[model samples]
Target: MQRKWMFTFILLVVGFMVAVQYNTVQQPSERDTRDIWAIRNELAKERKLHSELLTEVRALDETLDKYNASEEGNKGQALLETVEDLRQQAGITEQSGPGIVIDVVPSQESVAMGTPLHEISPELLTRFVNEVNRFKGLDMDIDGKRVTALSAIRDINGQTTVNGLPVTIPPFQIKILSPDIEKSEKLYNFLQSSSILDDFYLDDFILEINEPENNVKINGRSDQSENRYLKELPKGG
Candidate 1:
């Protein structure tokens, strides 16, 4: 009986040891499963971060594209405005403003005396134009022909010509534009007391200055010929 009791105690001890070993093995598998879940969570976070970075990069690219387009558009608009301004400065565009009209006619005395009307001298017209320019004439025209910086006033074959075009006889109009009404009034006042009138009288011509009128139009140059001597220079030359 004593031997059987000892044997039973030994079997119980062995069974407890086996149970502890089995529990240790099972705990390792459960821990490994938890570790795998943790690793998957970390991978998911990394993937989400990568996706957000890609989205931000794409947004930045789109913004950059929009900025480039806007910059190009602004450049184009600036170029157009510059071209228009140049056209205006070159007197290639029609201008209208408050100004005065000058009528050139034979003097009443000369007409009454039955004296033949003489053709206007180029020097007189040139001097008159210079005086008008000095008095703030922004634009001018002679008998409907636009006078520009490049216009040539001279005698061609005994006929007075402006920009190679013939000027009409006496009674032709000389239209001048001022920047504003105030300048127009100033010009009118100056002309009324100017010595240029005496010069006209000496030549048997009447320089009649009219009151300032609004909406005075001066046409642009009809000739579109470019200057043959003016050429664009090469870059870096």
Candidate 2:
């Protein structure tokens, strides 16, 4: 009876050990299943982060494109403004402001003396223009022809010409535009006391400078010919 009891107790101990081993093996499988679920969750999170990163990158690219486009547009606008300003400075555009009108006509004494209406000398006209320019004439026109820096005022075939165009005898107009009302007033005052009038009188001509008008228009230069000798220089040279 004692040996049987001992054998039974050994069998019970062996069964408990097998049961513990089996439980350990089953716990590993359950742990493996849980690990798989955790791995799937981590993968899903990584994919979501990647998708968000891609979205942010695309948004940044669109913003960069808009910024580039805006920069280009600003450059274009600045170029256009610069060109327009250059045109104004070069006197290629029409200008209007407060200024005076000068009428060159035969003097009453000369007309009464029966001196024939003769074409005013180019030298006299040039001197008059120089005087006006000295007194701050911003823009000028002789007989409706605009005078530019390159204008030629000389005699061609015994006819007085301004910018290669003939001026009508004795009653032609010279319109001058000043920068502002104050300058126009000052110019008018200077002309009133100028010696250039005496020079015109010597040439049997009368220069009549009218009062300043608020709206005086000077037309743009008619000649738009480009200089053939003016070539664009090489970059940085």
Candidate 3:
């Protein structure tokens, strides 16, 4: 998961860097369009891989839940308790705690109804999502959706169009769970330091954790690769 985050960040940075210089360095006119297409293709491929991994993770979690339930009084009971606590607190009847809500808006809030398709670019969206992920406990998905490992970088799944309805493009609205105000602010500030924040109006963000909770769940990934990777590393020998 950590590797994927870094990979995604690098991809986003590259995309933005290209977008920044797309027109200025107008020397190679013929290959310009082709190069842009190649970058977008790479982004799509990464999204597909992430999606596949996410599905695997979700399936593994289901299996763990079933096994945990059967072993009622086993040694893993404490772990089960933690999972249950996280789920309930993440969202249930009610949750009273400090959480951050990031509101992402288009470059122009009022882009006239009939504005052309090329009005906003994808790099803007990538930056907004990256900004949210910079925080220790914060991550996001499109609106209420949870970002699984396989979430796509671009809305279309490498397809030009599907069935009629269009895919989502960012300017994403992110909701994050942040326990500490100071740390959360630090993360937000770091994001603003980057030029992406300047491109959009971000006053809509609200960090409301006044109703703090005594406990917050730590819902971890179901992948065993983490353990394997660490065990195989140099220090493990």
Which portions of model 3 show Cα errors greater than 4 Å? 1-76, 82-96, 108-123, 148-150, 157-172, 199-237
Clashing residue pairs in candidate 3 are 50-150, 51-150, 98-209
TM-scores for candidates 1 onward, in order: 0.64, 0.64, 0.38
**Residue 52 Cα positional deviation in candidate 1, in Å, after optimal superposition:** 60
On residues 1-237, what C-alpha lDDT tens digit does candidate 3 reach at each position? 999999999999999999769865765556545687899998998997798799879967976776666656673765666567655434322332344555544445445444333322334455556656545455333444444333444535442221222334434344545667665566556654665555554422222222322333323322222233434447755
For model 2, residues 1-237, the per-residue Cα lDDT tens digits are 999999999999999999999998877655444587899999998997798799879966865565566676586675576567668666688999888999999999988989999888989989988888775338898988888777889989999887788988878888888889899999999999999999999999999999999999988777774778979999999
lDDT string, candidate 1, 126-182, tens digits: 998888876533789997778877788999999999878888889899999988999
Stretches of model 1 off by over 4 angstroms after superposition? 1-70, 229-237
Candidate lDDT values, in order:
0.85, 0.85, 0.50
